[model samples]
Target: MTPTSIRPFPRWDDARAATLDEPGLLLYRSNLLGSDLRITNYGGGNTSAKIRQTDPLSGETVEVLWVKGSGGDVGSMKLDGFSTLYMDKLRDLKKLYRGLAHEDEMVGYLPHCTFNLNSRAASIDTPLHSSLPYAHVDHMHPDAVIAIAAMAHSEAITRQVFEGTVGWLPWLRPGYELGQRLAEYDAAHPGLRGIVLAGHGLFSWGDTAKSCYENTVDLIERAQGWLAQQREAKKVAVFGGPAVQALPEPERDATLARLLPVLRGLSNEGAPKLLHLNTSAEVMEFVNSADLAPLAALGTSCPDHFLRTKIRPLIVPEAVYTLAGAELRAALGGLLAAYRADYAAYYERCKRANSPALRDPNPVVILLPRIGMVTIAKDKATARIAGEFYVNAINVMREANAVDRYVGLPEQEAFDIEYWLLEEAKLQRMPKPKPLVGKVALITGGAGGIGQAIARRFLSEGACVVLADIDAEALQGVEAELAKAHGKDHVRGAVCNVTDEASVIAAFDRAALEFGGVDILVSNAGIASAAPIDETSLALWNKNQSILATGYFLVGREAFKVMKAQGSGGSIVMIASKNGMVASAQASAYCAAKAAEIQLSRSFALEGAPLGIRSNVVNPDAVIRGSKIWTGQWSAERAAANKVDEGDLEAFYRERSMLKRSVFPEDIAEATYFFAAEHLSAKSTGNILNVDAGNLAAFTR
Candidate 1:
């Protein structure tokens, strides 16, 4: 190894360590370990330490294990994120451990034995940590470590590295039994520095936090070094050759435009959610090669991936890439059907004693040969996580390819971990999410006040959003801001002229490609042009009708086509104006065009019903004076027509209504939210929600 080999391992700098007491040090170490994305991902790993604390009731000093609490990311963990457990009692769990069936009950019992008996929720691996005799213990699922531990010769590799100083535990479903086995293995090897859990992860320990952390870094570094040697030894006769076959046209992004919605329709899992299309050069090379295709059929890199990516990935054949239209759809459908049938057969063959509920059979990662990788999940975050696992699995497999044969855990073992109740309990403990958690929403005029408010509201309700507008600069600003808050996958902005047929189609296509498909469509793009009948020009009438009325038809028709293709019911919330239902003087062009827009929405609702689509309207009158739609000339025109100051438009509407409350954009946004919610309006399509501050004339039965 040279002096400049990029280190491959984290080096210690004691001066930078936090000046903290034992408890604070535990938190400090957690933050340090978790901060490195290579050491630990978002919430994949955990850490713990042993400290002495007074047992208040008994008035005796007792050893306590401070383990990371469940549901908290290690990088951001605090003192509260660690559960204070009595070490002796936690170790007793290993004595009571019988088999995998009691693992959930055993984990449940850990919280009751805590120092306060009301401490933070304990990490599921508390017993595993408690069983070891070390003062500090650290566990993480580092990418490089997993590559070595997930191999067929994991035991041999461990024996070779530490020469019996480190122990190897075979694939055991993580719970009480695994914890018990760890203790037994540690006891047998008295000089153990750490242990690698095969097909799971790694654990390191020492008398001090620094030592334990360094031990982990050093151990992983050595494992990485071993793999690197194997890599250097690998030789290829030929890596490049003549074109294998004609490459797919228009590139992977264009192919995804055709495939994502169809692939999303194939799933019976959650709603149409996010798709992570990885078209990186590394990924593209693997998918195109005949050699790497068979490697994907094997099980996951580690059992942990089973929770997200499932046991195996589905590789859509190369032929479908060249096909198009009905023929392509049919071919893809046949491929999905075959994959499902095979999964059913696998489930039947490996199902446990008592019939266990099968997991969602839909493959999370779908490799489109010569195109790239497509990962799907219930939400944007999970899709990214699942994608990470698949990518890591592929990397590990590639490494195993260079070192030795890549071996996956057995099918029954996969089922054991897949159906583990303790694992499911962690998911159950998470709080219930907002109503539209898995749905996708597209909002028109999204950079405008009413449109931005509607987009933000839907995002808050857990709907992944796509913001559309004609103003490219404003659209980019809103997209960057929202993406920062909700993640880049959750919110996006597209420049769209709603009146144009091709642009409208492209916007929906972007939604289908960005997210898997569109679940909710908010047609909110329109303008307010105020003029007397004699003053209104033919051009004015044409422009107002084109956007206010025709825009809805164009965007609505595209959403319908996409929704119909998805084979799932969807919702469309049209932002019509109160002027549509109630006439206003000097606003002839605006009122006439809005009236046509509202009726168009009703017509869409009536026709949409048979297709399981819901079309609803929210008729909003004058918004707050400074709202986006009324910012410039539009605000001045409305103020002049109403004979009131621009700032008084809000007050004017408030005083005109029965409720006497200002009809801000938020009020209209609230109405749009209500109409989009399936629980609130599932049985009531063709509905018009009046948001004009309780104006009776605008209210519809």
Candidate 2:
């Protein structure tokens, strides 16, 4: 494919570029290059510009190398995300370098070279950028380029593809030594546009930011074009053709729904992990291919890929797919045990004296033939990004295998990079995990005000939520709003009528597919009705019971099913009403239904205790503001019953409470969050907390 066909055209706007200083131009160039995954995966590359700036301490002009800071993604970074180091200081560090063994000490000297006292830590790639003899430099992991770089004869392929315009360097882990080697090569061979780092990525440089960006894109496109040509000429099947055809869409989804929870449960021996499933055509092709096992065993070629996806994915054997129910689960448990044991052996084989204690041994990526790929991590974003990295790896493997034998980084070399002291320090520096991190919640009536509030609250604490609502329009709007605030990966929406058993089950399945499984169930879907017994029709009575009582039962039953399968225990928080414990006038049906919800909670608590599942209730009364139930006839009916105008209902409820406070959705959300949080309520199940602003009559006695 040509650049126009396979790669994105340069998005540089001259007008935009003209309005920025050198540092701004560098940022603009980095964003442009990082925006396209075809150019590089998220946080997989680094960019830099050597700019002249006033030295803050000396009040004199000096050249500073501004490079993407540690753990920052160039695609979504700001000016502050770049670390500024004095060029002279960086160059002077060459005197202290004591070869590869002491290369790590070089990182300690970096802060001493800070140009502007910038707090953003410089990445290991700083040397790679600072050593290059160019005003601007970009190092990227484009699949098309990595394909050529990961080949057995990568140097020969690089020479053939670029016709000597681009140079090639053999596999050397990124650090001071590699940077020195790069400088040596560039000095030895002047005028070369770029160098493909074998079994890694590509590095390109130019006199200006625009030139550097174009050079990088152009080189990647050229490699893409060559690979496309080679693939067309070969006319061979990918991964030696599909070993097994993919199941139909419905069957595939069912298979994933069945497998994900079990995998998630098995993988959560340490910190619980969220799961992300990828059923894209590319993923399907690779997983179903005959070469899947052998190629996967070779592991990933790029360090960025392996860091996120782990060295290699666990390939589920064909026999496991033939079993069903308990037999299938037992089979999977055995496989996971073996995988963990193997990972332990790998650590034993490669660990050094000072290496960080063995990390999580469970596989991050799992490939199942006919079912696509599932990635597990501490959060939805990490899991999804891990899957994306694996996809990039798959692309590299596919293209390389089509032309020449693909080569993964040697195990010892991969181990050194994985267990590097600097990398371990970075991990140790990460912020503490949130309270609800790795927990998945399925919320019923999630489009409503209280539900949305609960969703937001849960999200803020780092839980993935699946919102289920019968109102499709409201559901979509709430989903978009929450996803915008807390990332698309952390929230999903399913239109579910809670009263319908199938809808309830589908909602749980959706949770399993979107995340791993349900760790918390918030049974908040409800309605309210007001009428004297004689005036209350059977239909009206049944409607209240159906939504309030049956809905809670259905959703709770499904949550219990998933939780039992996981064997990890879970929390169930029912949003009952104060009326459940207190009789109310002219609202017998509503009151009775709510009372049923309270009773069901106790029963669930009793039944779930042995399984490590806890059931609790949050009883919220007169929650008028931002409530969907109040927007209907229920508000006017209650106003009439209280002898107050519709607008005065809130004030009436407030004054009626002993605390003179009207409850809001957020208040109810707080109560629900308390019940759902294991750290707070793990030992307090079979209890009810009322959020009624001091309603004595409704108090649980």
Candidate 3:
């Protein structure tokens, strides 16, 4: 039988690859190969190359397997992302291995075989790549390929598509055993182009990286073509009855508004989950399918997807729309309880065969019929990836049904890999855990210098940040800057005047709409005014008070309202100034309004105490950078009132401080973070954190 080589080899010239070095070329190849989201969704696939390297100390040649490292995306992988494993040592582990009883134990087994002391943790599938008799190997979970591979009689379809050019291996939990099976299959099947793992993914190899990648694209394109043909010829059968409790068009967002908050709550597992609503046509089709219940209950198409998408999704039938308020909350709680209970039962059923402690019982993917699919995770990046994998799984299931009944690995098989050392290691070996992984922060003066710095700090710590300012252009610029560092979805900009009640409400509403809820508020918007008490006019005084004090009240009020309704206690950081704590000469309006802002914050702290809401004031003195408060006429007035030159103002404030250090916007940001930290300041509220470089006159006077 002729082999189905669908596409020609990919052109990987030096110009296209961007590098000529062995490792850099491999990274370039992996990136290009994994760039296609439909073929290899970000961070899910791997590539490896075999090369000879000389040990600097011993000066002996060694075979090295440079596989994609753990926790790194192939599309953006670099030299560091490829863990260098000594191939001879990895191959020799098979002889000493007493066989792994549980999957997690392989973590210990793997590091013990690494050749370099400072090497990153190798990809857990190093052995699988090492066993293949080729210089290069590319492995990917293409949706179209999985569609065909996950169907019942997938082996028969495999023969039909490739004409017996590729070998079909039934579900084997990946490890030493799977590695040995691949080696055995390679020996038996001569002239094999690739091997299709039933209910898993594909592995293709060649003498060069280009050939290996080309072969992968070839086989996947053929599988996609075959699945398309099958889908066109097949007729779908719909169930006779209509869906129960159908929701009207107007009620969909309303339902999401009500239910998403509950779904984004903290589980007993200590995991902070955020939700993404998926409303694509493909998702809706699967959500409304007649076999939605049974098909979804059949587990994921591959165990590799187990971490992103749990064993099974939480398929919320349309009938859930019938429940409301307390009744709705109770019903949702009951659904969670049922899911947890079923997961516990599944653990018990599978534990007899595989022993690893159980992970959180909450499902990652929640199907909401016509409403949309919801993906829950601890951060935006993870949630987005999880959601993408589910959509891929949905397409696979649909395509699988086109040819035959969609099927996946047996429950026990999926359980073994999901709990295995390699799979568990992929998640457990995280980067330095950010303090605000799932938290949402809103800054009122976000388009300004100090406010944007605070937003950047929170964003770096993994918080979704909303920037609200009257300057729409600056807001857009700041948002763009933040989005470059964090993802575009994690940073949002809204034009809001804290002096306007409606604007404040709209700002907080944007936060809830962008990220399901708000967890922190930095009320930092204000203007500075300087004048003798007699010269301070009503209009001047009112403008200063409106922005400096009333603005804080308006924004803080809206933020607290949302925080209270979320029932998930949050923090409110008021950006008051030193003028509030100490009397300033010729600055009656500024001093009075700032003092009022601090008092308002103290009042808010009292109201929020019973609800676990924390309110604190960060009183910073003349944080001049990016601060327009001291520019133009205000600068002259301030200098005259203080009897100092404009240039001397910086030194005057810094030298006057107990520490003689300049107070920066970042310094103020640090103080806000301190108060925002629940673990650090859980019992402390209505407190003033002075970020004034130790201003004795205004140090919490």
Better of 1 and 3 by TM-score: 1
Q: Which candidate number would show the highest lDDT if scored against the true structure?
A: 2
Evaluate all candidate structures by whole-model CA lDDT and list the values in order: 0.78, 0.92, 0.79
Query: What C-alpha RMSD separates each model from the true structure?
Result: 3.0, 1.2, 3.7
lDDT, model 1, position 62: 93
Candidate 1: residue 602 lDDT (0-100) = 84
In terms of lDDT, the poorest run of 10 residues in model 3 is 237-246
Q: Which segments of candidate 2 are over 4 A away from where they belong? A: 1-7
Candidate 1 lDDT, 107-215, residue by residue in tens: 7688767896645887677777887788999888876677778778889987886667778988777667777788788988888888888877888898888888788
What would the per-residue lDDT of candidate 2 be over residues 1-701, giving only the tens digit for each residue? 37356646566799999999999999999999888887888988999999988888889999999999999998899999999999999999999999998999999999999876799999999999999989999999999899999999999999999989989899998999999999999999998999989999999998998889888988888898999889889997899998998888888777777778887888996688999899898999999999998999999989999999889889997677667678878988998899889888988999899988988989999998988899999999999999999999999999999999899999988988999999999999999999999999999999999999999999999999999999999999999999999999889999999989988888998999889899999999989999998999999999999999999999999999899888799999999999999988999999999999999999999999999999999999999889999989999999888889999999999999999998999999999999899888889889999999998888788
Per-prediction TM-score, please?
A: 0.92, 0.98, 0.90
Best by TM-score: 2
Q: How many residue pairs clash in each candidate?
A: 0, 0, 3
Ranking by lDDT: 2, 3, 1
Q: After superposition, how far is residue 551 of candidate 3 from its true place, in Å?
A: 2.8
- Model 1 residue runs over 4 Å out of place are 1-16, 94-105, 161-165, 236-250, 270-272, 323-325, 428-430, 483-489, 696-701
* TM-score, candidate number 2: 0.98
Where does candidate 2 clash, by residue pair? none
Candidate 3, residue 94: how far the Cα is off, in Å: 4.2
Q: Lowest-scoring 10 consecutive residues by lDDT in candidate 2? A: 1-10
